[model samples]
Target: MAAPSRNTCGTRERSILDRVPPLLTDLYQFTMAYAYWRAGRHQDSAVFELFFRENPFCGSFSLFAGLNDCLTFLRSFHFTDEDVVFLRSVLPPATDPAFFQFLRGLDCSGVTLHSVPEGTVVFAREPLMEVAGPLAVVQLLETSLLCLVNYASLVCSNAARFRLACGPRRKLLEMGLRRAQGPDGGLTASRYSYIGGFDLTSNVQAGLLFGVPVAGTMAHSYVTSFTSLEEVWPRTLVTVNQDHDPVDLISLTKGWLGRVCELLGAEPGKIHEGELAAFLSYAIAYPQNFLPVIDSYSVTCSGLLNFCAVALALCELGYRPMGVRLDSGDLCKQSVDVRGVLRLCSEHFSISAFDSLIIVGTNNISEQTMVELNTKENEIDVFGVGTHLVTCTKQPSLGCVYKLVEARGRPRMKISEDPEKSTVPGRKAVYRLVDADGHPFLDLLCLALESPPEAGRPLSCHPLGGGSTSLSVTPAQVICLRQEMFTKGQVTQPLSSAAETKAQVQDSLQSLHPRHKRLQEPDSYTVALSETLHTLVTDLRRASTNKSNVVLAN
Candidate 1:
């Protein structure tokens, strides 16, 4: 294949700062934008916050992600000529020409955006993002913003759980491609995995689109294509290995190479168990020299011992076979004893095999077992995560919803029997209370300018030494959760690159406590009632509940 072009100069230098969103937004958003313009409420300043009432994956805290993407989407949001033309074609006969003309030049110019820079340990009801602008502008943004944030946050949180299980030592491969909901489903999962701390991904498209690292190895097809071990070794060495890796083990006898080869349906050789032991005795003699695959037979009883034989053979041959593989059977048990027998076999040959052999466990690994296996920290070196990792079959969605909180200077609320599902009234902002260490303790919601009582409350108190926790304000003491990302229907900020966005997510994961990162019952991040909002909630609750009671009483 020809190498991809490296054009130093190309088509028009793209406007990275003023990116526009695709025109295929939810129809309601456009209709609302048009209505606001028609009603002269297009420039009325308003505020709305984006938040969730429950954590995805049942975790206590969620790592913020997708802000970069959100910003990019905002910057690129506008109705193009093509969009206008298409609208003209699709509008009903009752549609007015003036409305279509207004939309022809329409773009996001009146909105101001603020967000809790992606990667904060946020909780339910804490505004992750805020959009204040003309009523129509804010309303139009609802669907797309929710669509981007909800799914990104969900996958980011799930990836964090996987990170907890693997820790810093184990490398992770995000294999969730085939099972993702749609193209964006898999695409977003790759982006989220990077933020949640995965090392690489198998999706080449995802890697290119998101700037994530890509990696893979020989699949089973390569193993089945060759006739003998000798042929396979010579072919691989000549085609892919020799120039890249030139070492002593690179030179081998054809006979020994043939003995090393084991293919599917190949007959077993006549070596006795003791002869097998003798061959492996010679195997571990060289270090960092060779690697052999051993899962062609029973991976437990005979597989473990056969691995020992290979190790011994390499030792006597003045080389160490790099590792063994377990492709079948209860991996949990095999992982435990493989370490034991490999140790015992190496010692018997007097080869001092500490850290000499690596064990690769592959096939059928799921999120559940991967979590459990990783916690144990055995001698397992790498995981060949295939089908399960690539296909995120369970909980493959982020149920993000967006509703109009206010319009035309009037407060609004969606009455729902499920209190947890109720929307708050009016425009608001979310603030966090910080401890002495400058870490956020809890998030409090309040009217845009109303300060909550706990904002300056001392976390801990002392009368004398000044060491007692006093309400201290540092330039770094409080982080403004929102920033201006758009204005006057135009994107004002530079679009976040995939790398920048991914880094933003990784940085956010650091602030969370360890227990709050688990996949099971995660420790909850605090979302609390502010004094004013608390009262408002109380009053609203009583009024609504009383109205229902009055109806019942009648």
Candidate 2:
């Protein structure tokens, strides 16, 4: 294989892929390659398919992702002199030096990849990607490709599920950096989360590197940093106009503070001056976007009061504060209470914009919590989700496997005692059948040489494989799902940007039947085989079972 061709992307994003050096794969991959070399089978042509057996998070579907990273990794794969030296010291002394020389010249030039488009909704048992190349190189690609696709696809699917749990209208923010595995894990989560329908992220590096929208607010420390208005000195604030003279904003804030205390029936002396000063400082810094965490001291007792006073003051100065965030307590109850306060202020002051101010729920929110929030009434406009969003706590890992399905132009199968573990042999074509309503009805697997089903034509297919039941229907639409993406050391397809892929996710979801995409008890999406494929696999399995003297049920 030739080093992945660098002609597909710009230098910046290309650098992300370049970091995936050839040594990134698992140790067993190289060991297998070495064994193949000793048998003079290293250069034999082979085909490997990457697919999962079930959906992650107990959901009915997954979104294809990390195609960009996979391409990048393949494009830049090469054993450097240093990598060879490391391998020499690690391998047994009986290892031939010529093997190291063979590795030095390995690259992805001969490899070709065909994959489902990134962000497209995919189901279990179907190939998300296919890689074909010389036996040794393609075998070595197994672990690394799975490593990139498994978690990338899992986190992306998890984020999408969170979006579904919250509905389409609510904003979803990814704040998983602190809870992510590491810097790269955070970066991966941030990038894929955006593509999975998140509106923004708190990771500045992700914003810089992947173009994810970045947003955040002052923390509890920012509020606790001040104790008196004196520390918030020169409390003058200027309008957006650079030439406008600074106004005595601190005085205005105090006046509003008194008004808020009276309107909310609170003691004027009860409001903490230090918290007020902190709010004042933050408001001055980001008047147009002064969202503050309100649960530090007291959401109702002091924090909310301080926020309202400073917010009203900023509004008086021709700037509207964005909103507030709740990080603790009964989130739904607090959200309701906070909304009541903001709505009362909006009506009292005739500040109609305040009626729509964002209320962010920053609890340790998960998909389950979001669902729970819907049953109880609340006014949370956004959810800044952490931990579970990136880590996929409900399901830690997606089980995607890469298997050699063909070698030297011959189809192969891994016959297993457990039928679930058996491999579907050979290169095949996949077609998605759409109903008259534009919803996908079934996915058909056919031998690569078979003619595809055309619209309005009746088709017969086995249910999965070797099943008695067969599907009988005429498809309104027939779409080829997998196509060549990378080949001849260059990307054959024009890769979409993350934003574009995100749009595709929404569109893909819309194309599925509602029942198939529901959160719980989702109707399983149908995947079946064409007559030719069904017969081929059934006979192959039967012959293998007979050879082992095992009687199989019909």
Candidate 3:
């Protein structure tokens, strides 16, 4: 595929370029590119793999996201004239102008990308993506790829944890726009939150740009607009019968309001005028979907009773009230109390639909809050999570690193004092092994040149570092996790829609064993190397140690 010509760059390309300039990369990337150009090794074939060392949010798996954005960046990868001019002005005087020319002509056309499809469940040390191309070109992609993947994966994992805590039936909404790091961060959170199983978002721009479903309820300001019942309904009579049975109170109030309004020559069926006016106005706007925030003043005294009256009045007008939102107070106790009120109204008013009214809780909810709420008896049907879902408060970052694993068709590895920091060497393939019941038992990494794992064949799986322990398994199914995302610098696969990607996440999570999905001290999923790959890793570690020892002696 030919590089996108500067003159022919369209609106979409320009949008991508605006978001990710060629100079968006770290300065070291350009310096290394220049060094490669000076040494005439810029075109050397190299392979780099992107992976994380540990799961974020203390969870066993992460939901892969942002591959679409990474692909977009790669497809439009090239330095503009402005970028070239900036580079010339900033580099050392000893640097060559030809290096700028090389950068100006650079594109990812020579690169081949292999990646696990976005929304797949990824674990530590498994290659999430691989880039193969000319050395300098692939090197230039490191920082941007990491930037896109790390935060996206982190947010998605956090959202997934929220989803797990809420269970399958409850609604999860992402309301992190105001609390996100920035505008772009807010948009990213909305996108990945949907991919991680959130049902909706409260960001309008995110909904417009990324097609995430947008939803919201009235704010406290809406509730505070009216000063008194008379202002809401002039000449309308209102009464509260405290002595009536709690179950029969809503019916009696409805009757009293009707009789007073009739005697006063006013709106006969208009409910309690002040707070109910706000709800009535909102109902006029969204008749079929009327969910009003009720806790602006009080839950039991003002909010719940007022909402019940307005909701029942709307039901009489042939509109089904969606629910009420509890934004403050003891959410667990308040939601149950609010539900009891709705139940009483449903019984008295003969509105069966009132029983299905959703109680939405949006008071600084977090994953821990969800877990705790799950243990308590509460009636919260929907949860709107903001800061914690988007910011990943438990563990803010997913430590994904992109490293060169092969150069000139020879395997390379980075050895570190901390073994966990060491890079796995070579061009590799990842296969998910499934057992008889179709649950993934383990992920097996092997040399790309080796034969793929065959189902029903017994194989020895060894963990890295020559450990004595090994897992013997005969897989019922073999699934190759990575697909060619970009071949010869052009996209090889169609980008998946957000909905499709979300479905992928849901399916992958369902296939995983429940134990691995646990939020606390979850069972670890096995990620092992094939026997041949383990042997290769062992040899490479020994060679690296020996070389270090020799260097010390010298």
Candidate 4:
């Protein structure tokens, strides 16, 4: 790939950003910007922090994602001529054209962004991203930034849970293309799911766009297409010997059917005709990658037996049968039973290929289902997870909020009646503290100017509540979590590929304590404030309270 232009305002970036209108923001953001402009506070320096208050799906951590997309939006943040015209039409009849001119000239050239890297495991209340610039310009970014990060992080976290359930060895495939929220949502899910440790996706468009590996098998409709064995039997069969005549196809088919009937204790003519035809046709079409959906009619009684017959025939003709898919019934028990049948067929036919056939389970599997299947003895080699992974039905949103934290060098915060809704004030820096065993014990948030915690030093940290917790650090390391993403509207870091980001997630998860990664009732990872930041927050709250009291007394 070519390096980005030094000018930072590339035609490619502008073209990509052109697709996103300036009016994509909420109407309230425009109103606020107008108010600031009227008061001559539009150009005043300000800071905003984007963070979530709680983990989605009741999990302990969230996978930070969509930083690349957010940077793209920032780089391409200009209002088009059409946008200004539309704004004029929407404004009141007596509105000034100077406001439209302001909109026309608006861009993000003065903004600086700092963010945790994509694929980082972040906790609630920690800043995922921070924007520092003019108050009006920064305010305009709130809606778009939240829209990009919220869904991406939610889907990525959900995929991480699924990855945990599948373990390290089992293959996990994203089969959610048909069930995703929309076309763009499907592509986004595939891209982030790869970063969250999925092996492949079934969406080919995503594969083309994001370089994610694409995979899929024939649907059940392919089976129903061949209504009878007569449509596929003799025509699709191939002779084992190259010198043998094509006329021997019928005899070969009959010989395989006889063996299958004898092993299954069924009459040759009474076998499942349509399923057998489909398997034969599909095998003939894709002999090297034949994985027939076996539960179209019956798994054990008919589908399994018919597949074994077709597979044995293919083996005799020098082709390796790939696998079988069980898409219905109790997948755990059905997989065990199907494996037994394959083993029995291998012994009966004296063929070793039957014993090694892959079994895939794909019937609406969820994270809990994967956990349950992991506990039981089963023969499934891969999981084709779909709706549950893409839709994130358990928790569809990751409540990420972008709030103003500082303005004109003064720390600011939003006080709320609910304590959880209260904002963390200031230009903050986040550091991950690793203990002697190399596990991250806690995350420390401090004023950006305050000195970072040093190694081999005992530090006192305070949680959101009033209590202070002390950690004795004899062999620990403190590492900064946030990096400079954008400076003066230019991206500072090269975008990471999906494979690289996936590896980062895997490595980060390895260093995280297992207690914090549990699916249910996970232990909360400590996110604390440094002494200076804690003191500043307390002082601000006290001052705000006194001012409110004075107003009421007056």
Better lDDT candidate (1, 4): 4
Give the worst 10-residue stretch by lDDT in candidate 3.
Answer: 233-242
Off by over 4 Å in 3: 1-17, 229-274, 465-468
TM-score of each: 0.74, 0.95, 0.90, 0.93
Best model number under TM-score = 2
lDDT of 2 by residue, 1-554 (tens): 12213442364366576556678778888888999998999999999999998887777898889898888788778888999999998888888899999999999999999988888899988888989999999998888888889988999999988988899888999999999998878888998999898999999877666667899988889889998988986689987664678988899988998898889998777678888888888888778889999888788988888888888888877887899999999999999999999999999988787887899998899999989998898999999999989999999889999987889998888888777788888888889999999999898888788999999999998766446677787899999998998897888877676677888888998898989878888988888888888888888888886877754442
lDDT of 3 by residue, 123-219 (tens): 9899999999999999999999998899988898888889999999899989999999998788889989988989999998666555678899788
Cα RMSD to the true fold for all candidates = 8.0, 3.7, 6.8, 3.4
Instruction: Report the Cα lDDT for residue 532, model 2.
Output: 87
Q: Which candidate leads in lDDT? A: 2
Stretches of candidate 1 exceeding 4 Å from the true structure: 1-21, 34-40, 229-327, 336-360, 374-377, 384-394, 436-439, 452-479, 488-507, 538-554
Put down candidate 4 lDDT per residue, 86-155, tens digits, no spaces.
7777766666678778988998899999999989999999999999999999999999999889988898
TM-score of 3: 0.90
After best superposition, candidate 4 residue 397: deviation in angstroms? 0.9
Residue-wise C-alpha lDDT for candidate 1, range 1-554, written one tens digit per residue: 12112221111113222322555467767676667777787777666768877776656776677776676666556677777778777655566788777766555656678777776667775667777776766677787788778777777767766677666776777766766666667777776776676777877866555567785533333333433333322221211222444333323332333343331222345322332322232232323443444454354434444445444444545444667656676666777777876665545446775356777677677778887786664667666554554344456555656655666666656668776777766667666555565556555556666753344444322111112223323222445465566666555665554456556666656555555666777666655544455556557767888999999999
Residue 5 miss distance in model 3 (angstroms): 27
Candidates' C-alpha lDDT: 0.58, 0.86, 0.82, 0.84
Q: What local lDDT does model 2 show for residue 346?
A: 92
Local error of candidate 1 at residue 551 (angstroms): 13
